[model samples]
Target: MPKVLDCLVNVHFGEREQPAWMLEVRDKYFKGPQSMYRQVDLAELIDEMDEQGVEKAILMYSIVKPSPTALKFVEEMPDRFALAVNGVDLLHPVSSLRELAALVHDLPVAYTTVGPSFWGDGMYPPTDAVYYPLYYKCAELGLPLCMNTGLPGPPIPGEVQNPIHLDRVCYRFPELKLCMIHGADPWWDVAIRLLIKYENLRLMTSAWSPKRLPDSLLHYMRTRGRDKVIFGSDWPVLPMRRLVPEALALDLPDDVRDNYLYRNAQEFFFGGRSAGGTAE
Candidate 1:
């Protein structure tokens, strides 16, 4: 089996420590006794990754206040994990950027994530000036800015999540690396166009099950966009056993499979350092 790097996994500190929104979302989307939303221990997560053949994963945390435990996990096991800091307060752009800088200055974080649909007023487009500072900071740090570009997990207005808003952001900040999470679904065609247009933008198949991935995305992944797409199991929302197998089972060529499964993420997060093996 090819090595894997799951680009988006959510790890709670513990059962009782999970956020209310998480429980609400779980109740809404996941039903039955076998749902993956049940509390997850860090050790259990590592075990699951090992069982699923995932060599490394990027743990995404809430922007409001990233879990200290999540940070500790990556710190303790740097080789097995990397952090993706989500939800920066764009309302206070300057100070938020400084605070974010301090947070990742010496940590094991690979990128900063923003959910345009859930952050701030929920109406500002991704290209709004409020987000420019954060983008500038990310560019300065050489860290990719990951954005949730489709319907968010929590109950929120989805209009702001449109992939079209990113055109201006990408054009304005050409040097900044952007990772569009969730495949920008429902508008993935627009995403495909953007990916083709921008060298620094990438897309990860987070949140969506592999079987549900659009045919357009699959075609792009196997051909022209091969180097621009990566794998992400939005864990707890989707189980590893289900996600890994389905993704690997796709009718993808060997080169595309290797790139999507790990190489793209390795380069995106670690500047070309493969997490499991030498980069091809």
Candidate 2:
């Protein structure tokens, strides 16, 4: 059996230091009147992964700010944790590129993630010129850039989450590896086309519960697109204990499961290394 690699986990969502706007968004989408948002501590998170047989998890940061605590967590357990940085100020592309270069060079960060929908309707589309420098920097660093697609969890403009915008990006940055987070949901057909069209592009099934995974995505994962789809628990939103087993219980073949669980992500993020180690 292959070890699990959870491609998306958030360690800072419900923390006290998290921004009020984020908490508000969480309350609206993730929490209910009878339920409260619970922040998972580092120890608890590690234990959960251990119990669920997860070999590694990528800890994603908020777009508003990168969490120092997340950096510390990955620093403490470099083998088990990988950081996915956020908050690159696209308005200041030059400085943002420098910061991204430094982060990938100096820290245990595996890559960066962004939600184009968070910037609102008319601003910062994935194809915007503002992201060109960042794409170039990522290609230079040999890091895959992950971005959220499909409907955002919060009540943000869903139009911005369209997978079509990425078409232009893929065309422009052919050398840059891109992971479309959330499997592009309602746009699965377009997402599949993108994956087939662009050798450098892949998809991560994060945020979507296994039971809730779209049939089209399941078909792609089990068949021709096996090597292009990756697994992620989107922790805090969906518990790994539940998500992992649900994914493993799918009708997918063993090899497909192995690739989705770890191998594909391993190659995409870590240069297809046979030896196991955290991203540096």
What RMSD, rounded to one decimal, does every model reach? 2.4, 2.6
Q: Who wins the TM-score comparison? A: 1
TM for every model, in the order presented, reads 0.92, 0.91
Span of 10 residues, lowest total lDDT, candidate 1: 30-39
Model 2 ranges off by over 4 Å: 17-28, 31-39, 62-64, 120-122, 274-280
| Clash pairs for candidate 1 | none
Cα shift from native, residue 60, model 1 (Å): 2.0
Considering every candidate listed, which one attains the maximal lDDT?
1
Per-residue lDDT of candidate 2, residues 53-148 (tens digit): 898888886445667667778878887888888888777767677777777777767778777887645356788787888788889889889988
Candidate 2 overall Cα lDDT vs. reference? 0.80
lDDT of each: 0.82, 0.80
